[model samples]
Target: MDPNIQGGSYDNPSQAACAHGHYGVAKLLLERGADPFSQGGRFTNALQAALFSESEAIVKLLLEKGVDPNPGNTLQVVAYYGFEAIVTLLLDDGADLNIQDKTHRNALHEAAMQGSEAIVNLLLERGTDPNIQGGAFGSALQAATYHNREAIVKLLLEKGADPNFQDVQGGLFGNALQAAALRGSGSIVKLLLEKGVDPNVQGGRYGNAITAAACNNCWWDDGREVVTRLLLDYGAILSDAP
Candidate 1:
């Protein structure tokens, strides 16, 4: 049988084996010269398939076979799922931390959005920039804030994340302040305010923090009012809201 013969639900045998965590089969196929870099299936390649399976052994086998760990922004995907072990493996293999996907989101942004504190800490300790802009939530701080990951939000702020930083790519909430306001995260909004975030820094779907607060649907009217009041107290300009 040709080792590289492509077929089946996964488009390739090696990818199927890796995706299903059939470690022994994946090893056998690789030893028989199956192309580890063959792209298909739900994942981009065998290495990514291994990641989906959470099989560190198969990941190591693919890496040893010289598969690109960073293929298809693999680091970002791993961070999104909060796979700390695999993330460490990729980083130790020298995967590019700065690589962003179509949304311009790096691994750190995914980690923050997923509320993966350990992964966020790991990325930060390894020099991942907290203030990288773009993606659905702008910066990692904004992602954490919007998702109501208070601990991650505090951690990002402690790691020197810029409170007033706005995404040049024009994210939905513009900045962390706006994101927190829209989510009705009063604690997070207060934290950002204390950090000196400019409540009126414009340029997002809602234009400014006050508008985002006005659009809050956090299921708690009091929470929205709290966030709105917090924004106002922090010098949010009502006239700046669109």
Candidate 2:
């Protein structure tokens, strides 16, 4: 047996410690020349794996050892899970709130996509861009609306998110109102309408808010009736002509 290959595999000791929640083992590994920031397959590191497991103690231990909390692979994991504590820890450790992944989505975008209101609020407070775009989802507002996160949508609106912000792909791609309408969140739709979002604005595939609602079937139930009434009250066209 090669002396260098004894005990545990040297390359993945940190990851093993993280998986087992053995902070002491992790510390020993770090002392014995383990790389705290080693990225293995899929860009996953010990810190990222610990965060994914929501192992707060292991995460803290890694951070204390100077592991970066906001590695790109880890950011998506934390954001996808709406891990508020980990997110705060990462931000406090100097993680860039505005750093985008390959899809150009920041933490705020991920929080919105998951409808994690607390995480979204925290990110916004930390200066995450509310309107950052990319991904198939569009903006944070659109993500919130798509997920039917009415409370988050309201919060984003209060934070000055553009109700009519166009999706980056163009042709009504990023409209929060369209997202709300598509999800059949009547309250959110009404709120968008009140905020002056055009009820008849044509989204790329859905055409208009009404059509967006109608196409979703579940959204076309009684919930959409209230939305339709609100749109009509605001002078949305009832005509079939685009």
Candidate 3:
């Protein structure tokens, strides 16, 4: 224990215990009237620090003691590290599955953005909206597609994510097919194509996935060839006009 926190307020003891994964010290502090939710210094609280450290034991202890697992800091840490176990614990404890962060990104969005397939599946199993939007980058599908997470994309598709859904920007910017093409994820593109994603769906500066791939130079050689052939096979029209 740090000398500064040894004799400090109840908040300090719990915070220090959480930081160091001192479950016994944390329990002691809580038993001695420490508020597990207290925030001080750089530490948001015992629960937040435990989640940050990926200390499953400490997190379970805090949850058992009734800490707010849905607190912004707790959610942030869970989302940042893709802690599938902690996420499950928090959900079982009734953490808000749709609680958004400062940027309006919920835990689902975070998991998808990081391409954590396990976390994504867990969130979806718990009824998290696959199409929840409002992140800096938009929906969870957009995050997965942009990152070229083919597994996540396939999972989201299986879970009924709207591949044709647009973002809050009022355009088709977040379309899964467009993102896959933009990133040169040919496998994802092929999956989307097979799923009946419109071959000519207009999005961003380009009119469709093929155009987007062509314009963004997503495929240098064989990637371009595959994308073009796939689009042509799907009846995508190519024109000289902008």
Q: Is 1 or 2 the stronger prediction by TM-score?
A: 1
* Residue-level lDDT tens digits of model 1 in 60-115: 88888787878877999899999899899899888998798876889999999999
Off by over 4 Å in 2: 1-11, 41-43, 170-173, 216-222, 240-242
Q: Where is the poorest 10-residue window by lDDT in model 3?
A: 1-10
Ranking by lDDT: 1, 3, 2
Give one digit per residue, the lDDT tens place, for model 2 in 166-226: 8856523457776676676888888888888877786655667766666644534657767
Q: What Cα-based lDDT does every candidate model obtain?
A: 0.85, 0.73, 0.75
Task: Please state the error at residue 165 of candidate 1 in Å.
Answer: 0.2
Task: Show the lowest summed lDDT stretch of 10 residues, model 2.
Answer: 1-10
Position 172, candidate 2: lDDT: 37
Best by TM-score: 1
In Å, residue 19's CA in model 2 sits off its true spot by 2.5
Cα-based lDDT at residue 239, candidate 1: 74
RMSD of each: 1.9, 3.1, 3.4
lDDT of 2 at 223: 70
What's the TM for model 1? 0.92
The C-alpha stretches of model 3 lying farther than 4 A from their native spots are: 1-11, 170-172, 205-207, 216-222, 240-242
Scored by lDDT, the top model is 1
